[model samples]
Target: MNLKKHILALTLLVSNFIFSQNTYVFLGSYNLDKSAESIQVYQLNTKNGNLNKITGVKNIINPSYLTVSPNGKYIYACTDTKTPNAGSVSSFEFNPENKTLTFLNKQTSGGENPVYVSVHKNGKWLVNANYTEGSVSVHPLLENGTIDSTAQNFQYTDGSVHKERQTRSHVHSAIFSPDFDYLFLPDLGADKIRCYQFDEKQKKPLTEAKVAFTKTNLEAGPRHFTFHPNQKFGYCIEEMAGSISVYKYKNGTLQKIQRINTHSDEIKEGFASSDIHISPDGKFLYASNRGKENNIAIFAIDKKGLLKNVGYQSTLGDHPRIFALDETGKFLIATNVNSGNVIVFQRNPKTGLLKKTGNEIQMENVSCVQIKKIKP
Candidate 1:
């Protein structure tokens, strides 16, 4: 109750309150086949791991994957088309004051069924991956946050071991290296991770990487990829074979070092594995499995860039397509596409384990989850 002590405490309380009022999260969904809102918003409680719905952005359909600009002033979504061989990417200007997204424009994805979209680090380019047509496209971004013309579209023409799913090329993910100097495109149908050197200065942003590409198991369908915090190693999750492939990365060359199973026990064929992400501290890695077992598998990362299976956690829903950690690494949210809900879990940073927070959002066909920190 001293005069100076009370003033200092009051200032700290006000600063903390201001920070709490500025955190938000965005959810993207596949609302075409279900009765749910599209592009919903939630406010994140900084003190506790809970989410509160703020508002929902309407008029967008099948925004399966979402990305935010480097400056956090724009939002990009893969707005998929129902018609076969048609896909597009949409950009919107975000108003942080009101947490409203204003649609800017859409650009043809240059391929079919775009499953992923990302904004380049330079803030001048956008990248998208079309799954059905097995092509990766790069588009230019206007200064006003709208999309310009597509700069390049490269198609992959090859098949792997699977007869049903690998009969043709299927590009699943396009991820940039930690340094932003290279692009890694994982092809499910081809069972390969194609590497391309990404130079923003060139007329064509992408060229064949120095090492070209690396092949996974014969029938392994690679779905997603992630890089370690040290930038010395890379990890990729195989969708068809339910495994993880770790590689040593240097100067655009990937040398496979180890391959491990995401699942503890081998199940029958036709199971699916999804997203992969490394913890911010690079101490742990996580992967999602759907099909038979709907769970998130956890792994511990050793000092030499290897994964040790820790355990698994049930997602509490079916078809866990995607999940994301908050910017602070305090919570993890998993989006179950088929079950139409998203669940939240509090993180134990020391142990790299997750505990269910018992918070869930009932979204229709939730496809993607993104965490956006609001400005003060």
Candidate 2:
């Protein structure tokens, strides 16, 4: 009986090890030269939030933002290879068997300084937001995952309150609604969230919605927008004001439900909140504050889809521009662009708080972080 008990315990341990999922960490950076390593991949150990370097690639200049394909076989990045004023979007193929990324092809991003890129769920269309030129660029995806040339482009010339920053439209991020019926452009310079109807079947996929745009608070500088997993609520991070606007989402329309400050009231000026993301379970929300705070503000979601301030965690570095949570919501990785460090934190599922795991890596000018779980 003693031997049988020992064998049962050993079998259970082996089964658990075999069933664990493999998590991959992808980082995009703004490297000055094309020869230096700009995009790096790592394998993350979920048990302790440690990252093991898999492979690093170069030859692409300033691949600042990255997004994985829905099927997890490719990655799309916003970069500028030739001239800073004429940015481009590049594609790469990921091999899970050997854990490597190979450069595919790139195309012009329709405007200058493409800041964000996202792929459709069906993997047929790609969209990017141009920051400097204030435009939206659309591309068709070839069967082999390469991006075709730009098919359509929309330019925005309106401005808002700030004399310098908001003098013209600055399209910061392009995000698709949960149902994929519409695309939302958070224009930092325009102080508005522009809505467009998306039809994948058509060559020109974006059309002006009935409600062309929704006005945000003057000088809010909306940076990034994300929807809750429940798909009933959405959140936008206001960069200039350092606040979040919660909304009721339906049929590509956003009705503001509540607005909350991302930082402590006592700590007032120099607010530059960069990115916002919610837990996969829809119980918690995390937003990164860059300029003065350099910390992540944590919030808990109530039954009414409202947010309550829970706590804050220092990112262990400076200028936390972007951070991402793993699919399982167990680990949150924060990347600092100026300090050039990546820190991983283990999250508590019940309390929605993050604790540093003492696992970190250093890379210069790292602007984006993306986590994916590759299937076997």
Candidate 3:
């Protein structure tokens, strides 16, 4: 082949590859007695693994936990508040072309302090966790991504030994199984993960499972849980004990397998866990530890879904409340609430360990981090 022709062909191939890959990061701020709530958007350069703020700063109202749509065209956040009993979930239509978001609609969360929200796999129903009210609510979503007014709310009164944290059942998070057949609600105050048969078409739970399983340690305060991609195994992070418990789930039944501590043996007291997540490839798991131990615990996932501690890495900031992995699994962003910054880390694919990239973005009371791929 002629030299000129070969060069042209290579240029075309490179351009096509670059155009097919894109990513963006959206951060949720706590507001923390501030004037306005805000969410920051950033465009990620896939080639160099660098991130640049693209949407400037869009202000909302106390957006605590944010979730992106399955199609990546919309972003939803929980607008948590206590004044006048106004708590709602807001939706934003994302413009991937310009990396901007447009406010779509807002709907009441049916309870106070809606700290967490999740969309079912079918994208037909939205579930919320009301921390202060200790309840779970389900809202139906319209085709335009707006929520319906009618909601189904359920409150729990169970409690465990942890009088301070679990005095009243506090629903922390609600997640659906991969098949959208069952809904799992983690209650910090009850120290239990309740299972419900979810009916997406009806937008409500069919009936309570005969057996509702509780965690091994009462007052451990299970806050969040993440399931494996295959849907056979799951892991839950305990906020009070700073530990993780592995479980084998099948046919709506969860059997405890193992529990591992997030802190070192030498260190004692003043440690709490915030969030837990599994990699897209289902090969590794990561959990965040706050309060004195500002680090991420990395674990390797075996074929049997057992967890083996790989290692731990400092988040390079204080209070790593929440962290998320980029779609490509190349970068991880940890939101440091106390430090008022979001620290970026590069993930080693083979070892599943995080290395600080030395690129930190400053923000106030950052609580949650969510990422989506942008369109060209």
Candidate 4:
């Protein structure tokens, strides 16, 4: 081999090795003051399941939820939460090499209390769900990591059985299907999962699907929706009912296959289930419960796309509003919103079990957790 060519090849190998050893973790929280830091960054040691603090960004109010762009160069967050008619979505440019986020721009969320934000696979569209106003907003994403003005907005006013919690529509989450051709929005107050067809090429990419929506149990209150890795099944977590509904998905249509309770039989009232996620290998599913049980329910996935309850793991703190599994499925991070702690658990891939690693961080009101493995 030539001298210069050999040296260049060796440098590339070393760079790849370094990138494989670490992943980046982004945290979002509710800030007491507008000037306080609402977002934090950490470097995760993939080998040992430990996190090292990187930096924190301030001046953005209530960045309670965050999503990274497909290319991992940009982050979009729902901001100004709980502020009447002042909800907004902000964009930031992320530099993975330095583990920093630079604020780019912000746009109105079209409603109040924007709770969830999701980016399409093509990285050209962004969507958010407003809880208080029960609306969904869509925007065009520019190549420079800044978000354009809202291109479309939809509002709903229907309510369900619950007198207090379901008095009106409460759109909690906006999630895209695995193929990026459909969007499923879980409405907590309406007890419905609204379906939409998406085409990035169109001026208005979001439209109602043929089957408009799927109704859940009378007072289920679906909060978050997620698709299985196989793309044939979908899961929705019910906040009020404390149950997880399994659905068969096809062509943007959802058919309820199963509805199972997420809480134990000992507890009856105050059911508040929060988030749901499947392992990368598609062998297990995990859901978080907040209200009386601060634990995660683990289920084993059968070949027919059904869930069998395996066991429950304590979150090691209270109010586990959100949790995320690392890309490699080696670690799971759970954020306790009420207890103000972040706990890391070592995952057993074969058995789908989680064990506490004694690795935890303290941060008040931490509500969201996201992990991304960046490549050089």
Candidate 5:
């Protein structure tokens, strides 16, 4: 072949390879009936916002909440089931080229009904919240991204007055600070946000005077909390009372600055708030409201770390359990459980508003949405 022709062919090959790298949407499905678990995976076209199911129509038990590893090579799922004992967390190696998952191993979560799991920033530890046991547990991550045995477990023993929801302490979610120095456990039943001294080097939790606790409104039932990427502020979604509590963090202490109702005054019926998240740029906050409300409440974060109501958008489905922001901060996906679908929205970066993208991916009882980038 001529030199010019060979160069042109190589360029075309590179362009084709780049175009083939697919963005994926992974849904964690829940099975209230059997034990065999399944997670749905779909290939998403970034150019036109189209989703095609690649594989994983089968069932996987209890992968209700999921988090991708820092390297984006592994995906960890919190199976909210108690097989012989309590539920456990599992790891899966991801193949970005083919959009498939390979199971690695599982570790007992050291409590019951493990709802959420997150990896420490250093990638040295994995933390989980056990709802039924009302506890938080830490697991060491092996060099290959699998979890070691449970190293440390802390059980919360307090409860509040919401008879149906807060009868006992239920730790719904645990997350690390941006600096990875401390861990925050939001216990729904206890009406408290428990701060723990995290030892990254030792892969354990320490009981120390550094512990700080913040109180939520009685019967508020704090579910999931997310910190602003800048680490100056935090937000928590109260499940039972359907409210959002804003907090300011300084020197390892969290001070409650404001609490805002997630719903309008006209809708007085009780609803359950599910997940809370802040945008990557810290300009907006999003919370999911389930039950009859069935919408995502959006807020604008002011310069002073206070939230001003932006607006609310219906998830366009039932039981909006969890929603996630894409890596580019350009799109948001809401997992509607009862409706068995995930609705996509295009995010306006400048205004921090979400517009319906008219893209809905069908699945079964999807409780959580997770995204992983396809490597080149």
Candidate 6:
């Protein structure tokens, strides 16, 4: 009986290890020269939030933002640049067998300084936000995961209240609505969340939606936007203004609900807020505050769609550029751009709080963490 008990326990442990999912972490980064590798891949252990380096992709310059397709067969990156006609978007085939990326093709983004890129759930179109030239563009994606060409584009010329930072239109992020019916763009320089009707089934896809655009408070400088899992509430993290603006969302239209500051009262100077994302369950929201207070501001979302400050936690590094939660929402990885490290934190699902796991992945200027789960 004793031998049988030990055998049963050992067999169960091996079965669990084989059945567990392997998560692939793709780190986007800034590459100064062509020789320096920019994109790094790692396998994150689910048992503990530890990252093991897998491989690195070189020759791509400054992939500031990355998005994986729904099918997990393609990876898209936005090349961060300022020179006119130089900014671009690149697509690659994600090989699951060896965990490597193969160059597919590249297309010119509508304008300079392409900062963010998001893909349609159907995998038909890839949208990019141009910061320096204040424009947005959409490209047709191939069935085999290669990019074809730019299909449609829009340019925003207006500037906002900030004299230096808001000198002209800066398109920060372009994200598809929950149902993939509309495309919402947050323009930092224009202080607006621009809306457009998107139809990937058409010959030429992007067009104006029922409501062309929604305006935030003047000088708000909306940088990033995230939708609730329920699809009724929307949140925008303002960059220059350092606040989160809540809205009631439906059919590509956003109606203002409430607004709250992400920084504490003591944080008066050097306010720069970067990214925002809600938990998978939609019970909590997280926003990164850069500049003076380098920490992530946590908030709880009540049933009424209102936000209450839960707490703030240190990022253990400078300039938390972007962060993402795992598939299970059990762990979070934050990329600190200035401090050149990516830190992992264990999350409590019940309380929606983060505790650093003390496992750090040292890198060079990582800007984004895109998580993909590998299924057996």
Most lDDT-accurate candidate = 2
List the candidates' TM-scores in order: 0.96, 0.96, 0.93, 0.95, 0.91, 0.95
Candidate 6 on 64-89: residue-level lDDT in tens? 88998988888899875544568899
Residue-by-residue lDDT tens digits, candidate 2, 1-376: 9999999999987765543436789999988777788999988887777788888888888899999998888999998823566799999999867878999999999888999999999999999999999999999999898999988899999999899889999999999999888999999999999999999889899999999999999989999999999999999999999999999999999999999999878777878999999999999999999977899999999978899999999999999999999998999999999999999999999999999999999999999999998776
Which segments of model 2 are wrong by more than 4 Å? 1-15, 18-21, 81-83
lDDT of 3 by residue, 1-376 (tens): 6999999999997885664356888888777454444787877665555678766335567888899887777788898554348788988887867656788888888778888888877677888888877888888878898878746888888788875777788888988877778888888888888888886666355457766655558777888988998999989998888888999988777889889887766668776899999888899999999888899999999998988888999988889988998777878889998898888888888999998887888988888898777565
Q: Which stretches of candidate 4 lie over 4 Å from their true place?
A: 1-17
lDDT of 1 by residue, 53-125 (tens): 7776777778889988888788898986444767999988877677577889999998989998877898998
Q: Judged by TM-score relative to the true structure, which candidate is superior, 2 or 3?
A: 2
Clashing pairs in 6: none
lDDT of 4 by residue, 1-376 (tens): 5999999999987875586555888999988576767898888887777889887888888899999888889889999998876999999988866767899999999999999999999899999999999999999999898999999999999999999999999999999988999888899989999989999999899989998899999889999988899999999999999999999888998888898989988988889999999999999999999978899999999988899999899999989999999999989999999998999999999889999988999988999999988776
Query: Local error of candidate 5 at 120, Å?
Result: 1.1
Give per-residue CA lDDT, model 5, range 1-376, as digits (tens).
Answer: 6999999999987775565445677778676545433677777665555677766623347688888887777788887464546698988877766757888888888888888999987677888899988988788888888899998888877899877777788999988877877888889999999887776777355454265678889988899999998889988999888898888887567888999988767778676899988888889998989998898888999898998888888999999999988777778899998998899888888888888888997777888888766666
- Candidate 5 lDDT (Cα, 0 to 1): 0.82
Root-mean-square deviation per candidate: 1.7, 1.8, 2.3, 3.0, 3.4, 1.9
Ten-residue stretch with the least lDDT total in model 3: 29-38
Candidate 1 ranges beyond 4 A from true positions:
33-36, 266-268
- Between candidates 5 and 6, the one scoring higher on TM-score is 6
Q: Rank the candidates by lDDT, best first.
A: 2, 4, 6, 1, 5, 3
Least well predicted 10-residue stretch by lDDT in candidate 4: 13-22
